[model samples]
Target: MYTFDSFKEVIASSNKTDWDKLKQVMTIIQTVQESKDQALYDYSETFDNVKLDTLEVMQTDLESAYHDIEDDLRAALELAYKNIWDYQQSIKISDGEASELYQKVHPLNRVGVYVPGGTAPLVSTVLMTAVLAKVAGVSEIVVTTPPQQNGVNQAILAACHIAKVDRVFQVGGAQAIAALAYGTETVPAVDKIAGPGNQYVALAKKMVYGDVGIDSIAGPSEIVIVADDTTRADFVAYDLLAQAEHDVLARTFLISESKEKIEEIQRKVNELAGEQPRAAIIKTSLRDHHYSVHTVDKAETIDCVNFIAGEHVSIQTKDASSYIDQINTAGALFIGDCSPEAIGDYIAGPSHVLPTGGTARFSSGLTVNDFLRTNSIIALKKESFKNMAPGGMRLALEESLQAHHDSLACRMEENK
Candidate 1:
């Protein structure tokens, strides 16, 4: 059912949409715009099945969360924090040394990070987003997530504590995005918003793009694995299943030159799917979204992989590193058999929040750079100004802007 003759066919067939669903999301965002805090409270009750007195997570609750978490989990969170912080620090923009014609990078005044919470707690997302903002020297980092009947997940709260988040609000979905885009009484409006969520959240971000900056409209998780006979079928199968379990919409692909290897991997996938805890989700994802392509050679496989432009790509060829240079359009590349996508998801020193739905062709994963804004420095000395005045005047005249030419002429007269 998932067979494809060429990469072009695969690209053409990647459409997944329902206009009615998007319209509903738009209506909800509009409602939030009208109602503000009341809309948030109503949505929390209607969708999340929780009645809340307040939208903000209290400071006492955050402290209790840190104390509530087990020692081992805290240690793991600390290690992840260190690795992510160190990696971000290493790549942070340094002060411009040039006297002119340079750019100065500075952190945003405030940012909002959305961590998804409902069935499961995404504590890692809290670290993946907030830690980068902290390392980028952001003055304020506000966190917003869906709350259970009791409150926000303790692990997420603990992560907030570790990342030194400035504020946490128990709100989610499109309403949460709307709240962040337009300030409510409880949640302060953010300069930019970052993090992943369901389709409604993605649409809300799309609607609010110009009002506030957004990271990306992330889709479901996806991975493409290019393997040869050397790669184990079981390993490939589990890798595909791992991504599939993320959501019923999540997709996984196996591209190989050997038909025999592809068959073996498919068989292993069926065998393992029955054993997974989230087997229903894995089954639906595999049935609807997963594909195994058989190419004539490694070159064709590589081209197909590039066309897919997956969020995560695992190359299990003889020399995995050899293919890295050719991989021009992937959110992240897992080089070898040992390098599972999980490593990058957890402690691989890169943010797991990546561009999805083939957006890797242009965009990239989340990083400290996303938290920064660059201002171009144009410091023209008197000599440089005089040298460029003639050209500036000529261009201004060519464009029929007398005022622009006069400004340059006046500056030249001052030099004279």
Candidate 2:
């Protein structure tokens, strides 16, 4: 772990776009574009070691998934769905209209949501993206996930059902992103693509950005906890360990004014990591990515947080709530000791799909706005146009555009 005396000493990469993966991702995308679903099948077999005859997940599969999951699991997912849906409604924006100018909000015709199918099933991801799209009133929501032995995971399918996803495709990785960006024979093209995936998937999204809108190029999961001497060492250690378990690249930053507190948390992290199931992964991540920063006071702690702009910021100081407004750049702020970063990953109302690699500096988490498009309207009467023409003509002439000047000039002359 690196110990930094000041926030300026803390260093982080702003954009984590892997240019090295571009060549491989480009090849996959090109093959998908040429061979279409055939490439999807071949890649699935090559990577996932599964041979698939069909690409789409049928309605029967979804129904079977509902029956496959346990009653308790289903109930938990149902509650999470409602919570996410409620949060989305609370923050959704409305259309505005006036006498002459207005903005009309329309949902995209169709959208594609990519959910990474790794060792553990990402059921919450299915709910996070698809539910937001559904709330936005998207005409059709399509989900693409890595194909399993049966098809998609049962829990994930149950999530798709709960979110009212229009369709599901048994494809993942770069090829799935390619299929979404450029329509193939089976997988239809979508207006936008949103979700979290591995490096290949992230690079593919960057490659196909112009072809389709993407929520954000999500990086490794991360969390920053600003704890002072008053903070609980166990709570701070637990939060940091949870972050490291995400992956080898996942980062954890602990900023505190007290050197003794930082040392206490570090020791606790070392002790707890030994007992964790994903101990190896967590240890490797902490060894390489973890940083225990020493600051002069609480203000310096927050300054370092804003500088890093981590995905999750858990303020565990004496009065954590007082610093929430000061943290201008976190993807999501957990403003107390009780709110662990894990809660936001699942049961919390906000979508855990967040900007990483210091991208919270500019981009935002997935929301209804990602699926909605707005267009501005302008309508003016004769007097309104006449009143506005002279100013418009002056600027046009100053730019030496005679045609622009003539367009407004002729309109004013005709109106007179």
Candidate 3:
């Protein structure tokens, strides 16, 4: 069982920013920028250790992917697609307060989604990123995933089909980010790049930030479960492992007022984690990243939860919904016993692409808002224009922008 530590100290240690990796990541990005598709071929051989005949997966093969995958998976993907799109549509473009000057919403023309082909194929990510873009009316959505020994995963292909992703590329890592940002012969330049990837891919996104929009500097997946006496130790244990199974660095924590309750959950975690299929991964993840805290009271527990700002927060405490407003930093909240973070990861309406690394303090999970850009529309009436011009010209003159003031003067003169 894991021992409880000083919550502040444990949270501080998790901030592992690798500035050294910047140079190497930049080199990979530059290589793709210069070599284009041939660079993709070389990197495929060098990093992925798989040779590729073509950069893009053919359209026919993409559409036929549904037939190749299992019937259950296809059904699941289709259902998830509909749910995700529905959620996105619900939150989109509601300028309830009509004004003469309002925002004009427009979706990005194209986006590139990077699906990691590592430990798991991340088939759900296909729906999370692509379908949301589709709902936002993005013209084209392309996906980039690393290839496995047997080519792309059939389920991933099936997901692409279900999500209606326009293009699928067999490229990944920093090179994939580079190719997406600065187009290669096969992969066209995208307006933005979405989806999560490994550290190199994350660093590449950081490098290409200005050239193309990225969803976020995604860190490992995490979940923080707050339990009370009414909470089931087994449920908390499994939820902890749910996040732990993601990666060795994935964070999990149990915070409760009673030390006995925390200990019981830890004990349950030990018993359940070993029996899991990803038991080896779960063990490593817990040993490396899991933390425990014993809060003196409800106020202390709330403070701890806000400080961590976990990607997913599950409350099993009594009257959980009443405490929702107190914890303001979580990326997604799973309230009550029946609602779990795992549901949010899959069938839940919202995108599972939430902020990690305590960034939920300042950011939010992916949504239709992330895909939509807003432009201020100003068609000022003569009265409003006259009202604003005097102040605007005065400010422009004070700021030493003579041309700006002159332009406003010219307009005013023409109107008179």
Please tell me which predicted candidate would have the highest TM-score against the true structure: 1
TM-score of 1: 0.97
Compared with the true structure, the alpha-carbon lDDT of candidate 2 equals: 0.88
lDDT of 2 by residue, 43-125 (tens): 99998888998999887778789878999999999999999999998988878966677888889999999998867668999
Give residue 76's lDDT in candidate 2 (0 to 100): 91
Give the TM-score of each candidate: 0.97, 0.96, 0.96
Off by more than 4 A, model 2: 1-18
Q: Write the per-residue lDDT of candidate 1 for residues 131-242, one digit (tens) a residue.
A: 9999999999999999787778899999999899989999999889999999887889999999999888898898899999999999889999988888898889999989
Best candidate, lDDT-wise?
A: 1
Query: What clash pairs does model 3 have?
Result: none
Query: For model 2, which pairs clash?
Result: none
Span of 10 residues, lowest total lDDT, candidate 3 = 1-10
Error of 3 at 376 (Å): 1.1
